[model samples]
Target: MNIRKRYLTLILIVAIALGAVGTYVGLSVFAEDTSLNNSGFANSDPDLIAELADQQENIEENMGKMSKVVDAFSIIQENYVEEVEDTQLIEGAIQGMLGSLEDPYSVYMDQETMKQFNEQIESSFEGIGAEVSMKEGNVTIVAPIKDSPAEEAGLKPNDQILSVDGESVEGLDLYEAVNKIRGEKGSTVVLEVNRPGVEDPLEVEITRDSIPLETVYADTKEKNGKLIGVIELTSFSENTANDFEKELSQLEEQGIEGLVIDVRGNPGGLLPEVEQILKNFIPKDTPYIQIEDPSGKKTRYFSKIEKAKGYPIVTLINEGSASASEILSAALNEALDYEIVGETSFGKGTVQQTVSMGDGSTIKITRFKWLTPDGNSIHEVGVKPTIEQKMPDYYYTNPVQVEEPLTLDQSDSKIENVQIMLEGLGYEPGRTDGYFNEATKSAVEAFQQDQETEVTGKVDEKTAELLQTAIIEKVQEGEDDLQLEKAVETLTK
Candidate 1:
């Protein structure tokens, strides 16, 4: 698409996407603009006027095709056992239309839900601070925001939420599940999560709080006598691009010889933000990303930067890196030949835009599929790293659920997790094969002693909590960040 056409398309989408109040304010301002003609519309944009006209015609034709639907609504209103609200019927019809698309990403949100969504766009909300999506009829976590309650509670990407508190979320939509997950700050919500590779479900209690909107974090690591700048993106929020540029400039001023762009646990946000960040590194010779519309028409977007960075750069990603994160990783790897070091990312290649129904309600529809720089769509298949690296075994271990003290000879998965945690904490448990033998007891006793707890020589509730806490602290210390080390090595070598 040409620049003007693309601008018009974006305007149309935004005009439709804004909430009812926003739309009214926007149109009121537009109508009062001095540039408007006698008809109270901008005559300067003839092309936009034509596009609007065409859209009106399409809407009219589609409305004509919906006569049968109207008839059905009338029949249901008149012949049903009980009277149905017109608002309910109307909302149902809208939902039915979106549901027919059979896409989990396309969903209908009522007025209340739309308000919460707008709050999210404005940044800051009371929730667990995690991105989630519908996958295989389950509400699965995309990734927890950095330092958020979800992350603190150890929620991982692809962790399927089975229940909220004690209620099952089996038939609820993504927004509904999210509503259940969100609450007033300081309120605790128990999530029953089914993590991959874990035989049993885990009950994680998370206290809701105001989720922070800070997206970019910058630091430096010295390897091989070279200072390697590390910029980790937690998400691509509204100010992420500006923050990234400032951080990058500071890093460059520090005379860093290498850089590692980490998007390990980033469940993506605003595409334009990632695009702006990519412009700093991706040369002008290639397109940074491509958007393919439903009609199979693709629009390639390129950065204006004429040259790549002088220093070597590497991208760090993992299963939690998704959407815009995948875009950045794929573009850097495919366009600039940068090494991607980590596990495959969370595949989310579609682009969604919300459209208001003009009544505070909204429908978020998947309008396009985003392709990588090489015209490859990583939809269900995530962006694979050039150098695949998995974290330590304890990083993937599940939380130990202690019903009773896990004594010697216990062969539960919880015991196995404890063993892994014990091993990761440097107290070798002899084996991680789920069997709690004599050596495992010794390992438990050692850990309890180190923790200055009662040395029971058996895994108990207090012992399990201590073990999980130690593992979290170790992971947070970044000492065992194998993927980051590999990334630094790649950049330095």
Candidate 2:
């Protein structure tokens, strides 16, 4: 009788607290009596019974809406023709929930994916060793790790992994594709690669191995009687800061005049690692990156440094450079006198935090949007270089220039093709005729000038190929990259 009174007193206290805020209070009535259902709550304390009834009504309301889903699940389990596992159903439901957000970065990872995720952060994993992302709904290779099987197999930037080991990856998620690609050491995985400008898919067979993450590749070169330090950072991983510091020490000891920090195909990693690296270049207590939460609460991360390196810096970025790379590049460009060369960065300014469920599963969710030190948001609108430079074809193996130049008044089938292409590109090449006239020469000269080529009236092989490649790909074309040359010139000056 004393125990019952104490339980009723505790229930009354909880009910009073909940009623103060007009919230329903729940009470387990039949926890001690297995035979008594929730319907038997009428026999309990009156005021406590009222609070319990309110909670029961709320539960029924929620469950009423879920009845359709329960019914469908039951029907699938019992009446469906093929057998379906409960695990698959639960995982599919979770995947659907995340997919409803329409975010490529937000995803649910299973046990295998969770394992690989941890392995990547630890800086060692058995796989082809490439960073991939879901771009335009396809598993696209951002870049291959240096000295890894993927790099050794000649996997270039922007290669699409279409299939793995004869299994199609048409609708596979990024993590799912990664699982398919990763295998035990010494095993081989055949990947069907779709490379730009290639007619058919190329079959690339790569032998997987334990790939150690070595993010920074450093070297020095003598140009214009000054030693220039060239540091190629692949990603900002766990040991990147230490590796970079060692390389920087080596270069500084040699008295390098300038530094060229290349992050051309870097897909980015660990924000804190990047912050640690940035502190070496930027001053102490300077605002490096700002992050905004969902409620618009902003937090600024500052550099923790004693002294700054006083060398002229140049950061090289391309379409593959993303996330941490963007932050570092933007900070250097905004806070220092460094020049950002190459194409615009791969803008992924939103930050994601992974939460583990303690059951070998995890969910990666977007939690914040990061801003540059200048308070500029670089999410979809990537960081544009001060000097705009386009990357040339990385896989151009043929001879660049043709044997003979196509001149004015020359009647050839190729002339007609060029005229058609020029007209299509809004160059006003007069007509798609076999004869190249003065109008054709003027159009060719205009095209060459726009392409940053010599303004020659005749269509040389370089000019012709550039025009054709640009027309087909709708991008810049050049055998010699003027951007790197410009960077070397800037360093010398």
Candidate 3:
């Protein structure tokens, strides 16, 4: 893989599940000819020169407004209650300027922040290596980088970070929460995580290391005597093309009859990397991706290679899949006639240009809009899969309410159900009695530890759900595996 590909990895890396609305942050390198050091501004364009002149005239006209701001700053510096650092004032001014745009995507990164931002796009970093976002007003894990410390620590997608090292992160900003998790190499950070399906906060201790961003995963599964190859792409990283080629060769040697390419939580990476990946499956003349500039001029990107051997291919995607992931599925569906399964994607159609300043600061601004090969704009409207099937709901249907934390020595009829469920799950919650006793507390603690929830020995909403779901799964084993069954059937058929 080329070093230039590493620079492109910064694209489409910002992905967070907002409350009802999810925002996918994507990196966009507008033109192949555009260099990272260059701003890609066409200085030779007469129209752009005219626009620049007009902008300068406007700045002269707005000189009075700038004077007022400068006057206010002088007044503050001269007569302020406390001495303020010049750097603080300057960075704060920059933040205020960008914040006034009302665009959450536009942010001002300081030296340290910019360093971390650039490191995030690199092949490796010293951290837990999990992509996080502010979802539902909480810090949530978008996806753990493959083979990274986060994945090794069992950090999963949609897992909410309740606290970091005993400090609650309820209202912490996304970047601040990320900073808290990042630390020196070999250092340890304990996180309190609240998972979606599980009812209870889990305590996860992770030792920070040099996290490697390995993207491709391949496996072979035999279903109904048919050999099926599964390639799971976590993200499009710098070495994704190389990793993919090796995986594809291995799968080919395995004599697989069909292939399933899963990009469920792929937050997307470099556009060129995805284009190269598509080349393996698409023909040379096929339109892989389309880019539309601000003036409505359209440009089509094509694959350089012909389609590989005829093999039934099925691609899996979900709402977590954004930008380049959507591009891959759209290209495969458009060119090779492959079927896409799973839910709708994270519809992020806009491309972002990462501008690096001379002072080591950076600003990522939205630049252009992207489209599928057939000229379908995916901005805010994600790619709809051919087979739109939501993952089966395994959450607890039975509501278990607890106004207060139930502890030992408290008498409540609710304790009986907890005891019965624990015993059924083989936790030995002691004697199915209505009274909450020490034996039951011990059982609850044991159950909570096993389920990786906070060992409060009390039934909270999370704990109760875990208990109910456990019992339900125990009662209904070998059932409700619809999505897996569908994938197997599709591959075997």
Candidate 1 residue pairs in backbone clash: none
> 4-66 in candidate 3: lDDT tens per residue?
223222211211011001111111223323223243344334454465456545544454445
Best by TM-score: 1
Greater lDDT among 1 and 2 belongs to 1
> Which stretches in model 2 have alpha-carbon errors above 4 Å?
1-75, 197-199, 306-308, 390-485
Instruction: Please rank every candidate by TM-score, starting with the best.
Output: 1, 3, 2
- TM-scores, all models, native as reference: 0.91, 0.68, 0.68
What TM-score does candidate 3 reach?
0.68
lDDT score for residue 290 of model 2: 90
Q: After best superposition, candidate 3 residue 258: deviation in angstroms?
A: 2.4
| Per-residue error (Å), model 2, residue 473 | 25
Candidate 2: residue 221 lDDT (0-100): 63
Give the whole-model CA lDDT for all candidates, comma-separated: 0.85, 0.75, 0.71
Residue ranges of candidate 3 with Cα displaced over 4 Å: 1-72, 134-138, 147-156, 159-163, 166-173, 190-207, 306-309, 377-382, 388-485
